[model samples]
Target: MPRIGVTGHVRLAEGTAELVYAELVATLTAHGDGALHGVTCLADGADQLFARAVAALGGTYEVILPATDYRTVVGDRKTFDDLLGKAVHVDYAPFATSEPAAYFAASELLLRRVDHLVAVWDGQPSDVVSSTANVVRTARDHGLPVTVIWPAGARRA
Candidate 1:
């Protein structure tokens, strides 16, 4: 199975973010067909969601951490174990630190390895930095398809 890269907004706090992530996990797992493609990525929001879901669904998963070392990146010992326990290694590279040009270059490398990009942007247009546009562009340049997921509109009561 081709790997699916997930990118999404990180504005959601503990409560709402957990619920949203749970749903996304379900969605991605349903989409994973196994054998043909296995899902994987960095261990963060959408990455965490997708990895956990894919593992539960019996699909192969890989972890792409943005730090030279897992312990350095994930201070939370438990979270680090959770992520490592489930994912396989695919090289380690820093993205936001003393270096930036290096980060973007590495981002391009990781993007090229995936088959599709699953973007989860918070529907707000004000977020210019981590906007879906950046992710979409990288994925397109790498010749991978994209699947975007935003918070579903508020439910009607």
Candidate 2:
């Protein structure tokens, strides 16, 4: 069983969700269907999409919250709750508050726990601390295999 983790932008342009989902399904399927596990933060855009794909393909979903009060920070409470409810395991970072540190901590935990990483990035550098590019670099530094997914017309908000 391979554990796949995801990191990507929270905002995506119109009509890109389907592309992201389809790419994820293809990527996960390539890994073979025997007990796949997906780890994600369940964030609005790419993270939530990846979780849905994992569930659709009979994989277990694991959620890692950046802080204890992650529900408040997540953009869509309904979607967050929906994914959280379906998660096989849920863990929170040691941080007490939701901040950049907490997000980085959660990212580190996600990268550390998974065997591979799936990054839904637009190939742009980010000024934010816990950007998808940063996570991909970290994963590569750790020797974890990475799959970057950016559809032809995909754009970030």
Candidate 3:
């Protein structure tokens, strides 16, 4: 069982989610060989897509909240709550609000718990401290294997 983790953009273009999810399933199945496990922050786009794919594959996943008020800032309330309920375990960062520092803290914690990282980025750098690219960089710095998934038709909104 591979403990894979995910980090990526939140605003995906229309119909991009399906493409990313398919790629995720393929990657996860190839890596886990059936028994799959994932770690995610459960944000709107990439994180939610990864969780759904994991469930579709009959895998388990854990959720990491960037802050106590993360849910308040997330885009899709219903989807976020549903995914949160399905998580095998949930962890929270020390911060009380959803900010860059809290997100960075959560990402660091998420990195420590997984053996591999999957980044669904568009290969762009961001000014935000805890951007997907930064997380990918951090994972690489720690010598963790990362698989970047950007399908042909995938685009960020």
Candidate 1 per-residue lDDT over residues 1-157, each given as its tens digit: 6576666553455555566566766666656555423344344455566666666666766655554544454335586577677666565555544133433444555676777777666544443433446666668766788776765652211
Candidate 3 lowest-lDDT run of ten: 25-34
Clashing pairs in 2: none
Which RMSD values do the candidates have, in order? 4.3, 1.1, 0.8
Which candidate ranks first by lDDT, i.e. highest? 3
For model 1, where is the 10-residue window of minimal lDDT? 96-105
**What lDDT would each prediction earn against the true structure?**
0.57, 0.89, 0.94
Flag the better candidate by TM-score, 2 or 3: 3
Candidate 3 TM-score versus the reference: 0.97
Number of clashes recorded per candidate: 7, 0, 0
Instruction: Identify the superior model by lDDT, candidate 2 or candidate 3.
Output: 3
For candidate 3, write residues 1-157 as lDDT tens digits: 8999999999999999989999988988888778999999998899999999999999999999999999999988999999999999999989999998999899999999999999999999877888999999999999999999999999999
Model 1 TM: 0.71
